[model samples]
Every structure is written in structure tokens, then in C-alpha cells.
Target: MHLPPPSEHTMVRTERVARRVFSRLNLALLLTGALAGCGGPMEPAPSALEPEGAQDVQAQALTYPSGSSQTVVSRRVVFRNGSGAYQAAAGFEHFRAAGAFDIALHNIRIAEVDAPATREALVLMSAGQKISSSGHSSGVTGQASNWDASCDSVSCPNVSLDGRSLAMKLRALGLFPSGKTYLSVVNDANFDHLFDSDTKQRIVNGFSNWLQAQVRPETRAIYLAGSSRGGCLMMRMAQALRANTALDGIDIYVSSFDGVCRNSQGELGTFDSKINNPVRPWGTFYGAWATNLTAQFPRRDRLHIFHVVGGQEVAPATGIRAFSGYAGSTPPSTGTNLDWGWYKQTWVKWQHKEIGNPYTDPSASDQAQAVAETVDAHLTWLDARLP
Candidate 1:
């Protein structure tokens, strides 16, 4: 208490010394903090630390109405050490898988909406006509031994084939657009007999009339797929449809798988040949008729005639060279008149019977992969072309 009464200058000098010591202590603390930060991890810049556009992320597994489920993740990215470098998380895989699924699902819904409300489709079988108990020439009726189409009622319109065929498989896979009523017509080896002059025009015309009656004002297009003799018969049926004035605006598409232009007499004819060595008139007529009808539709991709032939086709029973002639040698014979039909010689090393079967004949397992590929390609073609 007595020391406080000393001179004012002595008090001022003491205060200044205390202030200098406090400043030195503060500087020492700052240097120690900076050195510790350099030894440890540096704090990331706010912008780079968090992923861009990440907000309220809540992802879970999604289950569709069809009982299918998929795991979903919110897209995210992370940066390291305050640098711009980043790595994607599970969201990148989600983008590829979910993106494709969404696209395909969208395409299917769009197709269903765009298809005509009422339309007709046909799957003509390789079987020929059979004399029913009622004495009428009806197409064959029976279930296939394998997973192929079964014609419950032959020559009937809007009748569905119960079992699985190429077309039926496509429908099951949703390749064919919605609202289509499909029918499968069947026959046996006697199918070629209908091409005979004695019955060709009458039988074919009757079949054509039955089919034409099914087409109404609302019908937008006609799809015809056939194998073997049915493929050949489809040409004639198409001709009849072309002649009918009622179906002028309706488009027609034909798919012929291993068709042979053989007359009723079991003799082959060249395309547009009137020489008539075997005197098969229908053969010449069909080629010229197809050329004429296809000429009417000049629009590209409007009407399509597709012919697919198997390269390994040969006589199965006799093991002899047969059916190769139907493969076509030149442009006109290939049904390419003004780009009418697209012909393809497939690499599906299948014999005559196996090519049209629902699956490869069990004995021909070697060709199964090729057959599957061919079917997938055709399905893709139908998907792109169907309205």
C-alpha cells in the first residue's frame, strides 16, 4: 500500500513491460498451432468436400407391380484432401442398370399405346390341308410334340395358338405390339397339293376369303408368318389381299422361312419361267404377282417381305441334297424386285425340320445357340418395324 504512492513515471514503466511480455506469449502460441496443422490432415475446402447436387438423399430397394425388384442408390461422389479429384460410388452402377431398364420399359409402354386398338395377326404353319371327318378340306389340328404352336381350330379367325412358336415366343416377350389378335393355321405335307391347278385357285381363294373377312375398317395392318409350304402359300394369300379393294390402305407384312416354290406335281419352277417343262403355271404366276403387288407400295419401310433360309438345310430323311434351290440364285429369284422382300441366308446351321421348330430339335443341340440368335434378331426386327 505504501509503494503505490511512488512517482507516476515508475507506474507507467511497469505497465509497458507487462504489455510486451503478453504480446510475445500470443505469437508463440500461434506458431505452435500452425506446425501441428501441417503434421496432421488439412481440413478440406467446403465446396470440394461435399458432392455436387447432393441433397436429401434417401434411397431404397424398389419393387414393381410385377413382383420384380431392384436396389436403388442415390448418385454420389466424394473428393479427397481438398483436391478436385473424386470417385463415384454405387450410383454409377445404378445409372447403367437402372437406365437400361427404364428405357426398355418406356419403349414397351409407348408401343402399347401406339398400336391399333383392334388389329389382326396370323402365323401360318408348315402343315398342309387334311380331309376332316365332315369331308371338308380343313387345315391340320393337333398339338405339336415339342413346344410349338397347336392349332385348336384350323382356318378360324382370331383363334390363338396355345403352345409356343417363334411368333408366340415373340408375343410372350412383348415384342409384338398390344391389341393384336393372333391365329395360327396348320397343315401337313398335303399342303403342296393345294397348289395344284385342279385346286390351287379355289382352295387358296377360299382361304384368302376367310382371312379377308377378318380384316375390318379398324384394321391397320396384317402380319403373316409362315414356314415351308405355308411360306409359299403366303405369297398367294398376299396376292389375293392386294386384289381386294376393301384392304387398299391396310399394310401387309410377310415372313417366309424356308419357302419352296414347288408346284403340286412336286417339281420346282424358276422365277418367271413360262417354259412349263413340268407345266407348273402357278410358279410363274406367283413370282410375277409378287412383283406387281410389291410395286404398289413404293414407300420405304411401309411394307416388308422377309425370307430367311437355313444354310445347312438338306433332305433330312434321305440325307440327300434338297431344298437348296429355294435359297435363290439371282436378284429376281430372291424376291428382291424393287426391294420388295429382304432375303437372308442365316448362319443357323439347322436342317429342314429344325429350322421351323420352336426350339432346336433335341437331336440337333449343336444348332441351338444359332437358332436362338436368329429368333432374337427377328424379334428385334419386329420391334423396330411394328406400329
Candidate 2:
């Protein structure tokens, strides 16, 4: 026989009891997880610094992409950090197990809009003159060997250095997430093959696109890095970025290695010497970053700027040389919190022969590799300063 329906008051009372019991069960589960060193997904892991902003969002596993996809993530990006409006793109690289560790762009090309997108970014600008190339194609994690940035084309603008090695190193250190950190390079697409106004504007425009396209509420941190001529570009880019409103809330980190830059007047003279191309000189569009930055940020610690060079990088020879003397008239480089130099710091040659073997080789030394490690450490320390 069917039981009589319960009274309304009795049913209400029963529901209240059920709610209390469920709450207790939830608490028990939470306690169990904590005991096992597993915080609930909603809770960020204990961190000395501010936790990642997008850590609570669920995402798909990082898989290889099939094509060139550099679609930008639509978001409200401003121009508080730099000159032009923020912009960026991405392409996916799905390297097979057999894929070499060379200059291949690797998985997650900015080109693949369909591939997974991450709020955290690792952007790398290559040296001047050299375009994109397949770098250090045949290598694996945990093993050290020779590495090279073999570009896709012989022509400079046609090639760009791959950032797989840099990304890999960051990932191993837990600063960048696996498959989430989107690495990129913003070249002066319209350079008359020289670092002039046209090239500077082009780079600024590309970055504006990148900044506006790739950011979302999920975005947490952005790390911008460059080597040699690229370092100079990164500096100018960062200077311009300071004016962009898009970078207002996001954390930004910019680093340079053996970089060369134009003086306050947009001149690339040799430590106040003659210029290579007297027609025009490309600069930060504002002033020398090493000097002007001190006025821009003031706090010094608030600005996340890094510079690493090799002692072998001598004067009047490379960008680092230019950078070293950039402040010959000034003192205590601006925003350069982790300034360092090494002996065996040959640049273009190092990229060709000492890709994976930086610190080990005598001529190449371990400068680049050591600098990378320093970047990771510096980033972690910076994180600690955040809210």
C-alpha cells in the first residue's frame, strides 16, 4: 500500500535537515582534501606571491594544432602600457614525438584560433636582421646539446626564431603553464631591413594588435623577452606599452639580453660615435629607456625590467656594447633590476652553434642559459611583491 503524503510542515522540516547534513558532508570532503595536500579546485594553491588570476578556470589539455592560427583573443585591451593600441596573434605547432627540438615554432601557434588559448603569455623577440627560423630542431627535455635557430627562409624578414627552448625552460621552472603559455615574436614587419621609424611603427602596430586580441578577463601575467636587436625592440615596445591602457591591470615583465638601442634622439651611434645609417635613427619615441624609465615608473621596483649580457660581449661590437655605454652619460640603469654580464657572450655565432650548449662551451660559455635561469628566479621574486 502507498504511504500517506507527509504534512507540509513535516516536509519542510525534513528538507532543512537534509541541507544541514549536506553541508556537513561538504565540509568533511574539504577537510579530507586539505589533509592530502589537495585544495579544492576553487582555491588557489598556497603561493608566496599573488596567485594566477585564471587559475580557477577549467581548460582543455594542450594538444598539437594542425595549422597556422594567430587569431587574437577578443578582450578590452587599452594602451596604458605603450604607444599604439594593444594587439597580438598566435599560431599552433603540434610537434610529433619524432619532431626535432630545432627552430620549429612547436605546438600552439598563434595562427590556430581553434587551439586552446591561455591568459598567460611568453613573448620573445629575436635579434635584428634575422627573421623567424626553426631553432634547435632535434633535442629533448633533460638532455643538453647544440642548438640553433634555423629560420624558415634565407631572407631576414621571412624568418623568426622559434621559442620552444625558452618556453621549455620556463615550463620546467613552473613559471609558465604547459600548453597555456603562448610564446610569440613581434618583428618589425616593415623594416627597410633596418631599425628605423617604419620598422618601429610596424612593431608597435603588431603589439597593439596582439595586446588587444590576446587578452581577456582570464589573463594573469605577460612576460616579454628579446635577444640582441630584438632586445632593443622589446625595450621600445615596453616603453610604448606603458602608454597603452590595455595593460592597466595585467602584470608585465620585460627582459633583454645583449640588446642594442637608439639614443634619446633615436640615434644608434656607437657610444656617442657616428651612426650606421645617418638618414634616420630609431629610438623609444620618448627617450632613452634606461634613463627615461626612472622617471616613468619612479618606484623602480614596480617596473619588471631585466637586462642580462655576456662579458664576452665587448664594446662597439654588439647591442650589449651599445647598451653598456647607453648610460655613459647617466648612472644606475633604469628599471634594470637584474643587470648581469658574462665572458663568453658571442651572440649571432652563439645562436648558430651553441643553441643548447650555452654555459658549457668555452667561447659561448653558459651565459644565455644562466641568464634564462636568472629570469625565472627574478619573475618568482616579482610575484612575491604582488597583492
Candidate 3:
């Protein structure tokens, strides 16, 4: 969610949270760079072998019957790198049985953009350089292994060592061999440094970049979903697709978890006023990020957007506020709510912010259920619109 220039009160609160999150993040990045420079000093990689009685949850591989025309295909479609655009092999599996086709599973890479700027920020941060704005860094963290999960479960989950996890739970049941399903897993901070390159490029590109790649002639119906930054990317991509008219015949269904949105009013706010202050670091970070993403799609009315936020989650609370308070007219005023009305008329659908974190909080089971229900509703709409 993007915010305009903050009010005095809002700026003060935002500065505090921004400092805290950015400080720790900057330190972590510096430490990582230091260890890399030390070569042979860092610890060895962890063994995949599990300890005794570790509740072995084997990574289940996609299964297919032999001698059948039905085939499961998997690939990672790569786009931009620091040097230029390139296609990477995405791990995808196509399943066909009884004359039916379905995308059993696939992994998409979210590579970092503008590597030079990222490197400069890292160097300055490591050398104790202080900047007015918090340098760009991955928001969520966890091990890469966390993201390497089996698709058998409804919640097909993935995570990086830094604690950032992408957990998508699709509600559709009874898989058909001929039916098609699109599952997109976005790695927000999947970084790979090639030969001492300064910038760390994310493995999975953001939604905007990804959509630009898929707008090719070969692309067909798409079921898109993302969490956090990915969610912001998804929303912007939908807008782009709609405006371009390139996706006119394509059927699309998009969803986000704890995702942020750009508000029309451009003021900093929280999703839940009662639970959160007017401004926080999350709001600022998303504000900045969403601004960058939305700026790419000038005409945002082209695609239908479905958004969901947890009332309890800090990010969505701010998002909710931005949505409700969006001012569509010039000389924006506090009482004017333009985006709210436009959202109701368009495909913008929002649910109550009840679900906390889909990955961490068990209490948010109900919220998770709501998300699944919403996806089902979207799919129903999509099926009717496409084919």
C-alpha cells in the first residue's frame, strides 16, 4: 500500500518502526556479506538427512501412470537477470489422465530488479552508511528448504532461511487428469550472486515482471496468487493485463495473503484503526514498494482485483485503511472515499481482516478458510467468463 506525504503525527510513528526493522535488516545483510568475504570461514551447509525419529515427512514426488499419453510437465519460466532477460527452467509437472490436462505443480522465480542499486545499498549498509530511506531488503525470512515442499497438501508451502514463507492452500478437490490448474509460488528474496556480483537478485521475479513475461502468445488461462510483496505484484499485474487488452480472451483468477494495495488517496493509514496506529514501518515499506509496482501500470482499471487482509496483521490493517480512505477526486479530503465506491462497482473484492498469518497462526484457520472460499468464488466467476 502506497502512502502520500505523512502528517506530522504519522511521520513520527512511521520513523520509529522503520528504523527498528531497517536497522536489524541492514545488520543482517552486512553480516551475510562479511561472512561471504571471509571465504572458508563460514559454517558448512546443513545435511538433508533427518535426525532419528524426526517425524519423517518425505517430499512427495508427482505420480503419473506409465504408458499413458498423460504427462506431467514442470519448468521455471525465467525472465530478467542483472544482465538482461533470460528463461530459467522452472520445476513444473503436467498431469494428464483419461484425456485430461492439469498443472500438478510448478515453481516460478522472482529475480531482483536493478541489481546495481541493490549492490550499492548493500555496500553502504555494510560500511555503516546511513540513508534517509531504508535500503531495499527482503521483508520475510526462512530457509530455502522451507519452500521446497510436496504439493500433496492443500497448503503447498515454501520458505527461505530468512523466515519468508509462501504458503498457498487451494480449496478445489478431486483432481481431474483433463482439468487445468495454475499454481504460482513466488520467492520474494530468492537471491543468487553470480561470480562475486554485488547485487543479490531474487530467484522469483515480482508479479509485474512475471506477468510481462507471460503476456506472450503461448500463454493461456492463468490462475495467479501471491503473498505479501507477491500479492502487491499480482494486483498490479492484473491491472496491467486488463489495460493492455492482450489478456482479453484469457481467464484470470488472482489472490493474495496479507497483501498490500495502493490507495487512491495516497495517505498513510492502517487496515484496522482500532488495533493499529495510523502509520508503521510496514505501511511505509509497502507504501514505497506499492508505489514502484503501481507506477508500472498507469491504467489500473483493466483487470478485476480481489484482495484480502487480516485485521490483526499489521500490513493488511494499513491496507484496509488505505482502501477505505482512498480519495478518487482532486484536492483529496479525509471524508471523501472514491476508491471504496469504485471498488464496489469493479472486480475489487475484499474480505474482513480476521486471518492473521496463514503460515504461523493456528487461530487464523477460519481466515484461511475464508481465503479458500474467496478463491472458489473467483474460479467460478472465471470459468463462466473464459471458454
How high is the lDDT of residue 70 in model 1? 14
Task: Estimate every model's Cα lDDT from 0 to 1.
Answer: 0.37, 0.36, 0.30
Residue 141 in candidate 3 has what lDDT?
20
For model 3, state the Cα shift of residue 263 in Å. 9.1
Candidate number achieving the greatest TM-score relative to the actual structure: 1
Model 2, residue 171: C-alpha shift (Å): 2.8
- TM-score, candidate 1, is 0.47
Q: What total of clashing residue pairs does each candidate reach?
A: 4, 81, 45
Clashes of 1: 4
Tens digits of lDDT, candidate 3, 2-62: 8688774455345545644564576578768888888586766545442111111011111
Work out the TM-score per prediction: 0.47, 0.46, 0.37
Q: Give the residue spans of candidate 2 off by over 4 A.
A: 1-115, 118-128, 131-164, 177-180, 185-193, 264-290, 296-302, 310-320, 324-329, 332-387
| Higher-ranked by lDDT: 2 or 3 | 2
On residues 32-146, what C-alpha lDDT tens digit does candidate 2 reach at each position?
7787775445555646332121111111111111122122221111111245332221211112121222122111122111124654544443333233443322111111221
